[model samples]
Target: MEIDQPYGTPERDVMCVMVCGKLVDIDLHGRRYDGLVGLIRAGGTDMSEAMVAASAAWEYARYDSDQTMPGFRAAACQQGRGL
Candidate 1:
């Protein structure tokens, strides 16, 4: 999902959150993508926890949350690489 950036493309920086030596989450906030980047950047100890928080937003939030979004519940998160 990489794309040309306004300021020019930068090398992708792949960051991950490891839980017990396993990658539980990943962050590509500075990369050339959308959606999950904002969630990750919202701030957390790691991407995995951030992702969980973001996903849970749908349930815990009153409105304008991922849960309220039409398709967020079924949205596919990339939980790969032993996460």
Candidate 2:
């Protein structure tokens, strides 16, 4: 995981986590869901490892991690060009 301080939006310069090349929004303390609806873009690397880490928040997390809130799994991740 890497912090992208310049993850820009019309509102402001949102910070996001570069997880296996996928962009997951994060907060000052850690994982964030401030304005997130879902992943607005896709990734090149296998994003499962990064997905698990990104969805670590207790309320939104589960055994499958990706099944709970982030809402896209391994197969879906690679489908077409976006998720």
Candidate 3:
């Protein structure tokens, strides 16, 4: 798994999570948090759940000293990419 920090503005930060050459999640944080929350409230929990989990996992892995997101790495490896 890889956490990609693409170009973003002060109002929005784009975080992309890729596993086995496939994009599994994309998280937009910072000023867009409220909008995302509102979307979740108006939509449903299913999408929110996945995004939240991905965001949390990204945070944990990004901050950890080892800099490794084990879950995503394992999944990516199993899917045939060494990442």
Candidate 4:
């Protein structure tokens, strides 16, 4: 996965599915969201479907992720800071 620092929010990172990798704009159906709240709103009636969609988007982004990018860190790295 990758860390996506949103424009004008250096202190915060958007970890949503569609923003999982570098080429996030291609992830699918979530660029309109702001965060969990937005996603929940997008869910309207069924939150599960929204979650499934988010996961799919994450998987899609991860599938073509370029590990060399500065924000592209392995899931394993999230387990250990290594510092």
TM-score of each: 0.19, 0.21, 0.21, 0.16
Model 3 clashing residue pairs (backbone): none
Best by TM-score: 3
> What is candidate 4's lDDT per residue for 19-73, written digit by digit as tens?
3433322223344245321222322322223333332213223333333322323
TM-score of 2: 0.21
Model 4 TM-score on a 0 to 1 scale: 0.16
- lDDT digits (tens) for residues 5-80 of candidate 2: 3222411212234444465443233343443223333354333434433332212344333453344433334453
lDDT tens per residue, model 1, 5-53: 4312221222322233453334444533244433333233544333343
Where model 1 places Cα greater than 4 Å from the true spot, the runs are: 1-58, 63-70, 77-83
Find the 10 residues in a row with the least total lDDT in model 1.
Answer: 7-16
Give residue 36's lDDT in candidate 4 (0 to 100).
28
Instruction: List pairs with backbone clashes in candidate 4.
Output: none
lDDT of 1: 0.33
lDDT leader: 2
Candidate 4 structure lDDT: 0.30
At residue 6, candidate 4 shows an lDDT of: 27
Q: What's the distance in Å from true for residue 52, model 3?
A: 13
Error of 2 at 79 (Å): 29
Error of 3 at 10 (Å): 23
Error of 2 at 30 (Å): 22
Task: Point out the higher-scoring one by lDDT: 2 or 4.
Answer: 2
lDDT to native, each model: 0.33, 0.34, 0.33, 0.30
